[model samples]
Target chain A: MFDSHGFHQTAMAELAVAAQVSVGQIYRLFKSKEDIIEALVHDDADQWCGEMAEIQMRMDAGELTIVETFEQLLLHTIDEKDEALSFDILAESFRNAAVADTIGTMCQRFRTYIRYFACAANDKLSGEALDAAEEMILACLFGLGHRSLSRPRLSASSAARLTAEMIVTALGGVR
Target chain B: MFDSHGFHQTAMAELAVAAQVSVGQIYRLFKSKEDIIEALVHDDADQWCGEMAEIQMRMDAGELTIVETFEQLLLHTIDEKDEALSFDILAESFRNAAVADTIGTMCQRFRTYIRYFACAANDKLSGEALDAAEEMILACLFGLGHRSLSRPRLSASSAARLTAEMIVTALGGVR
Candidate 1:
């Protein structure tokens, strides 16, 4: 709804009314509409990062096979909430700096977290090798999720096995 | 513009006016808004398939390295037209049978094309192994392209190398 109306058309007063918060309170806490947008983006990113960390921990502890870990990642990334949040942020980011900054911060943090997990998943990976592994994993999964938006999707389990196998073959160290 | 207004808010009359075509002409050619949307989706998918066929030919001829081929694919996929087209069709597909059917057709065609290319790239890969490889290539590239939307992207060339190398490793053959 906000996307349809756009940030520009949707005023802070209207937002406060819609949110059932006093305009004074909205301004007092968020400072401005842009700040409010930034805060929401941050909240969404935090939620995603939190989920990713849990998945990473499971991977680190070897609770799931490489494929299962990938499946989990795909399910989360392609899940409707995450997909909507990503689309919303990307749509807004083109003309908005605060949103972009929030996203950049989130993605940077995500990179750090994923890199750590990639290493933990297989101690054999580190340095540049680890970086590539992280990039490949993230990029591939994002692509798969985006593709699923309009077409038939691979089952999460199937995608996980395929991805896990690919990563193992590529990196040669995942157990 | 359609995305900002959304599929529902964008009227056929408005679209016809924007395209400088009469409503009668629009209806005669496209049948309805959903048909017009399907036509657009088909146009984009056809263009993408054409591009892929060319890449496969070059790869088959040894005129391009796997990395170069991948870089070209990324440039095309992440190109503004493709991304916007994909997003538009996807946004509409959630509720429209015409759009969904159009996407289904495009995906089926794409799958056949990708499968053929995979085998050509590595005659040794077939059946399940080939299937897995095809899935990996497409999915990873999609993910990489999607990530690039919000984050700084790797040079198309670097991404090509990274993706090609991963696919080769996964499939264990590429000539």
Candidate 2:
């Protein structure tokens, strides 16, 4: 209903009718329409955080390459069949400050993970080179994710590989 | 009203009050709230198109470099101060497939302009080199635009300069 009618169009009365209950029933469950939307947003965030945590654990165990970690992340974000809750939230973030704030926090958290992975992958780098490497990785991840939304046919695996190669190449040019 | 309360939150009665007329007056002026929003969007788009057309004319006349063209585009978008409109519409887009359709059309138009500018800037490029250069420019423009919303302090001029440098450096690598 939210997807079809939007946040404002899906009123309490309509929700009641759709759920086969009275408006009062909805009030008893959710304080307001905004509350329902907040709940949905929180649920989506939790799911994404869980996925990132799992990836981080695998990386910590030294079971995943930097390339494999990023490929999984991109595939998780852009694979057509996946439930892209983060992507959905990001698309709407431009409109909703709350959504933007949530996504920003998530991005920061992801950046830390990317930085750690980059350092792990290329242990020889430090200072400016490492920072530039981290920045390029983040940029590529963000760029690829944005492009995938518009061009769904772009292979997620290939995109991730290319992004990894580009970051390495770009970093090499920094010094 | 749409900036603060959002499209759905702004009641017809409030608009009528703000316009100093009866509720019927608003309906007479705009068939629906969506119509009002569309008008606003069209007006903003027209303004941007006008500015971009002027910039294109100057570039074609050899009065502006590719870097200058990019700077003008970025500065214009940032200076508009209609971030709210873009945000609101983007949020609405996720819910309405029609919004996505509109965005895709806009993207194609922008891509054409990018290609034109790129061709003019680097007349010697051909084949894969041309494709990569175009892709890099598009990515930089769109990626930086997306980032600008979160980092408003990052002036369009600076971003454009950085983007121009990055694209030139990337192309240099390819060469």
Candidate 3:
């Protein structure tokens, strides 16, 4: 209900009806609609951060290329239906401060991971090159995700692979 | 008012006050709020199409590279305050059927322009290569616009130039 209808549009009455519970039951679990969304945001952030950690570990163990590690992480995140719903809410988080803060934090964490990976991939590249590469990869991932929502013909795995190729190609120019 | 507050938040009374007219006067000009937004979307589409046509003419005259022409056109469109407002409204148009239809039509026109330029620029490339180039450029433009909204330090012109260079380098396998 919250995925299709926005946070503001999902009323307590509708939620109660959908859950087969009284409005009081809703209040017991959530203080307000904002609380529900905030909880969702936190849960998603934790999951994303965990994925980033796992990818980093794989990279450290020489089990994955920086590109492959990041692509796998992103593909896994987007492939989950619940994760996709959470992502939609986060994208629309521009309308809500709590959601925006959560998203901003997650983005920062993701960038940190990218920076670390870029440094590991090539220590000689200047900070600006690394920043640009990270920016491009991040943009490609989320942009492709948003595009895929409407253009279902483009699979998430394909988009992730393309993003990985672009990033690797860009990084090859760093030297 | 509608641009910032959204359609539901902007009452007819508020709009009438902004226009220095009675609430009834608004109904006289348009049947409903949706009607007013529809008119705005129509005007926006026409303006963008006109600008795109001018760009095409310049490109045909050898005044710019295909990538440069498209980037300039997009940068100019995003710089227009009215167009930005229209973009914001169109972002929400997913919730409105009529607005969605208008936006879809406008997007189709833009895609056609991209296809034409991509084909012209990469005349020797295979169909798949041309399609990849087109999608890469489009993704860059989308990313640049969305990023610029949050980080105004990156001017549209610089972003456009960087995006063009990135696309050309990526497609030519220079990087």
Candidate 4:
């Protein structure tokens, strides 16, 4: 419902109908729409963190190369469902402080995962260089999410692979 | 109003009041809110293209290095007003085909500007490598817009410089 109608436009009644639950039931489960959004954000973060953990383990075990793992991370940001809703909430975050805090927390968690990947990709990367690499990669992933709204020539996987290779090269080249 | 209240939530009357015009006058000027949005997008694109043209001219004159020009372009995407409104319309674009087309045109123009920068940054980059460099940089710029919502440790200048350097390195390194 949030994906199609946006957070503000989506009503509790509409969400109830979509979820196959009564409005009262929704109130019982979640205090308000903001609460629901917070829960959803946390749920999404947990899922992404779990996937990152698995990929991190793979990296540790030498099951995936640094570029491959970076590509995998970039690929995770391409889901249509998550992409639209994220833009929706992101706009809402501008008006709502609580939503901003929730989004900040989620972003912080995602950054931690990206930082770990950056470390594994280039041990020579440290301090400001490390932060820059992580932040640039973060921007790429977030920017890729916006690409679905635009027409791009490359397939998502191809785009992800190219982006990963670029970032890894940058990391390797950085002083 | 679209930046604060969103496209759907902002009424025609409210928009008229905000512009200090009567609702009927607004109707005379724009057929619908979507028309206003399309106009706004085109106006914004024109301004950006004008800026890019100026930068391109400077590049041709050898007044600025490739990384400096790239950083200047990246810095253009960081205005808070434009960033918020962009996210708002971007979410609306998911629901409105007309708005989507407007966004697509704007994106195409922006991509052209970035492509020129990519070519200038590395003469060897061509075909898929050139496209990849431009798209990756596009992602970084868009992602940087989103970073204002999150807390980024690096200042916009620092981030832009770091991102530009990284992408230029990748462009040079690409086979």
The residue pairs found clashing in candidate 1 are A139-B143, A139-B144, A140-B140, A142-B143, A143-B142, A143-B143
**Which scores better on lDDT, 3 or 4?**
4
Q: DockQ for each candidate? A: 0.30, 0.18, 0.25, 0.71
- lDDT for B130 in candidate 4 is 76
| Residue range A14-66, candidate 1, lDDT tens digits | 98898899999888898877787788778877987898889887876889766
Q: Runs in model 1 with CA error above 4 Å?
A: A1-41, A62-68, A78-89, A95-98, A121-131, A147-154, A173-175, B1-18, B21-24, B65-68, B80-85, B121-129, B173-175
Tell me, by DockQ, which candidate is best.
Answer: 4
TM-score of 4: 0.96
lDDT of each residue in A100-156, candidate 4, tens digit only: 998898889888988988888788888888888878888888888678666888888
Give lDDT: candidate 2, residue B27.
Answer: 91
Best by lDDT: 4
TM-score (2 decimals) of chain A in model 4:
0.94
The TM-score, computed over Cα atoms with residue i paired to residue i, of candidate 1 is 0.75
Per-residue lDDT of A131 in model 3: 58
For candidate 3 chain A, the 10 contiguous residues with the lowest summed lDDT are A145-154
Candidate 1: count of backbone clashes, pairs at least 3 residues apart or interchain: 6
Which candidate model has the greater DockQ, 1 or 4? 4
Q: In model 2, what are the clashing residue pairs, if there are any?
A: A95-B87
Per-candidate TM equals 0.75, 0.66, 0.75, 0.96
Ranking by lDDT: 4, 1, 3, 2
Interface RMSD values for all candidates: 4.5, 4.7, 4.6, 1.3
Estimate, for each residue in B1-175, the C-alpha lDDT of model 4 and write its tens digit: 8887777789999999989999999999999988998898899879889999999999889998988887887788754465557777787788889989988988898889888888887778888777778779888888876787668888888887887788788777788
Across A1-175, the per-residue lDDT of candidate 2 in tens digits comes to 7665565666799999999999999999998765676677666557766887788789789887665776666556544322233333344565667666765665566656766766666677566455444444544445555553243323556555544443444444443
lDDT of 1 at B103: 78
